[model samples]
Every structure is written in structure tokens, then in C-alpha cells.
Target: MGDGALSGWERSSTARVIAPARPRKLAKVPFVELADGRLQGVVSSGSDIGRVYVSSVTAGEFAYACSTNNNRPCGGARGSYCNHIAAMVKEAVLQYGAERVARYLKCDLADAEPDAASLTRAMLATRPPAGDSKAAATVFSRFLRHLAYLEFDPATAPLPEMQWFPPTRAVA
Candidate 1:
């Protein structure tokens, strides 16, 4: 009753103050490096799905922030670039060099992209003479372990034990 009954001047003295302006959204996206050392970003355009974009420091990386079709954030998912985009950019830079990365942006993956799965398969399929199935299996197991380290999230899915062993190491 005391302050409520006070005049306009008294009310002004006790009024709440407004805080300073701040950015409307969060920035920074998580990125993962491939075995080949390329960076990739995880950007969500809509529907919780995002696309990867290759980038360069000079060109500032390609972003879809200004599209009117979607009100979602352009450079990133919600105003800042996301990790998917970052990863793609990093990978491109590492794989093709900065100059090649720029040229790749204009082309599609089918033209000269390296197929990681196929490469991995080929590497694992190589066999040595002496009819060594055990050695072959061991080599394949190591390859799988390496793949798990690169592409898997250790917190959730741990790599399985390699079952292969050299024949010399096998029990008599």
C-alpha cells in the first residue's frame, strides 16, 4: 500500500531496470575429423536433418543462411554455422588442398570423390601367400578397429575385440 499509493515520481524510483541486449541464439557446432583429415560440419536446415558444406578460410565457406524458403538459421542451424558444415569444409581442405577444395565446391562427389568404404574393403581383402587365413583375419581386425576409432562415438559404441591372430600365435 505504501509504494502502490505513491505518486508517479515515487514509482519511477523503484521501477525495474532492463538488461543489456544479447545474441538471440547459440553458436559453435561439434566437428569430427576423418582418417584422411577432412573436417565436416553437421548443419540442420529443417526436419532435424542437415547437409555438409566444404569450406575455405578465404571464401568464408558456403552457407545457406539467406534462403527464404526456410526461416531456420542460414550460416548454421540457428544463426551460426553448425558442425556438419565445419566437418565437410575441413575434410575438403585436407583432402584436396585449399585450391582443390575451392574447385570441388563447384563439382559433385561422383567426379573424383574417394570411396572410403570401398577403400577399406580393398585394404582388408588383401591376402598373403603361405595360405595364412589367421594372418589375413588379424589384419582385417586391425583395419576394423581403426575404422571404429575414426567413425564411431566411443561413449556409446565401443569397438569390438579383433578375433584374428597370426598362426604362430595360435594355440598348438
Candidate 2:
């Protein structure tokens, strides 16, 4: 009690948790998140309901990648961003907003209120030297790990791994 000031850890408990940019309806896309220095997640296959694609875009470099659950490279992602990648990006903008998502991918914005389509275009304009297909495996593994948690019984107490996600309005 010699120095009467609260440490940073003490202040953190009382710090206000900021709400998410918007409500995220995780129906079509089960997982979409900004993590591991990239924007990535597993997106449902439009044609086959049973199939899911792992997609990601690295920050700054914008090295994109997309593949199936079994590591088959996405046909549409050969030279440009594919439909699965598009859908994931769209969902990200919805969950995190265009501004935040754009900033995450390090895209230079030209619009006042940018949306998913505009943000994707901006990232593409960067002309990434190559698409990092290697990222697909990492993204898929992370998605699988998250899915494992769903099999557990619901609980009020949050586990350490569950706390990785950004806080929403309910948590705040």
C-alpha cells in the first residue's frame, strides 16, 4: 500500500469491453475470424452442403489461399481470389465491418463507407506475387479445433481457449 496506484492488471478487470462492430449471424459460415496475422476461416461449399473450404488472406502481403477439408486446392483460387475466399471476406466485413476488415488486410481504402465487394477489390489490386496455399492447412486445423469445442456441454464459465474471440455486446 506504499504507492496507492492500481497496476495495469488490476485496471484491466474494470476496463470496459468494447462491443463488436455488428451482429454476426454464423449460419452459412461457421467460423470467420482475424487471427494469426491473417483473416481466415472455414466457409461452406456453395455446391456441396457436405463440403467446407478453408480460406485465408495474409495481412500486408494479401497472399490468399483456399482449399477443401481434405486439402484439395480450390479450382477458382488458381490466379485470383476464389468464390470461397469471396464469401469468407464478405462474412468478415459483416462481422467486423469494412473499415476494420480492410485495415486487417492492410488494404488502402478509397470509399467513405466501404463494403465487402469494395474491400475485396482493394486487396486484389495489390497484385500479390503468389497465393499461399500452405495457409489453407493451418486455417483448416484451427477451424477443426474450434469445432471440437462445440461438442462439449454448454457452461457459464468461459475456458481460456474460448476467450480468444473478440468480446461482443453480451460479454461487455
Candidate 3:
């Protein structure tokens, strides 16, 4: 496995992937946008295949759901950030461009790479400072409500489906 690769934990347990962990390079995989604004596709891998599902959690933030266990840590018990979801974000950026992705998510696409710390700061910074009642009022309902929901159930919350995407081309 490359230094950048990540092996996902077991879908049912906290055990990390014990097999050869590889980074997924799915550049050619086409995705269809589902009715709920999620991108859906099938990662072909002989008999050990799986489905890939990605959704814009909020502007700039994304959520991933997969049927396979070998993936980076997105919506898993281990962490909020993961390579599997990062792959999906790259796909969305490639398909729709960073501008569109950012517009849809309500943040800068340049900050969409899956760095949880930066993402958190950027998210909090978007708020209307501390005393700007006017700006706060304008964005309070939408942003605060969404933020509340996210706080209630962080991205680490297990999604019933599962998550993962294998590399299309192996990188050296």
C-alpha cells in the first residue's frame, strides 16, 4: 500500500482492515445523481464488488455510504474524515467542477479535501461573527439548524448501508 492509502475498519466492528490497503483511483467511474442529491455508482471488482454512494452533507461537506468495508474513514466509528469519501468528493469535483460543488455545499470547494480541522474552522467561521445580529438573523435559521443537526449526529455516526471504493488505477 502507498503511504497515502487507508484501509477502512470493519463495518460491524472497530477492527481496521487487515488486508492490503490501497487508494482508490476512480476517475472513469460515472455517477448518477440520485433524487436526494446523492451520487451513486457501482465499483466493479469481480465478485468482491460494492456500491458507492456520496451525498453533499452541506455545502463543502460530503457524506459517503458504501457496501464494502475496505475504505478510508468517512462516516465510520473511527473518524469523520476518510479516503473513501474523499474519492467521492473528487468525483463530484471532476464531474461538476469545484465551483458547482462548493455552491451546492455552501462553502469553498478548495476547502473540500476532507481535512476535518480546517473544515470545522471554515464551517464555524462562516457564521456571522459573534455580535452581528443582522447577518446572524439572515443566516441563523438555515445555518444554525443544519449545524445543530450535524452536532446532534456527527459524520462519524454509522450509516446503515456501509462505505468504500477501490482504486481504479494503482498508484506507485
lDDT scores of the candidates, listed in order: 0.31, 0.80, 0.38
lDDT of 1 at 63: 25
Residue runs of model 1 more than 4 Å from their true location after superposition: 1-61, 65-76, 106-172
TM-score winner between 1 and 2, please give it. 2
lDDT of 3 by residue, 85-108 (tens): 344455654554444445555565
Off by over 4 Å in 3: 1-28, 32-47, 50-77, 109-172
Lowest summed lDDT across 10 adjacent residues in model 2 is found at 163-172
- Candidate 2, 1-172: lDDT as tens digits: 3598876746764343444546677767789889988999898887898899888888898888888888888888888898888888999888877777887788887764588888888788877655667877788788888889979988798587654454545420
TM-score of structure candidate 2:
0.76
* Per-candidate count of clashing residue pairs (backbone under 3 Å): 20, 0, 7
Q: Among these predicted structures, which one has the highest TM-score?
A: 2
Per-residue lDDT, model 2, residue 24, is: 78
Q: Between candidates 2 and 3, which one is better according to TM-score?
A: 2
**What global local distance difference test value does model 1 have?**
0.31
> Which residue runs of candidate 2 sit more than 4 Å off their true CA positions?
1-12, 16-18, 155-172
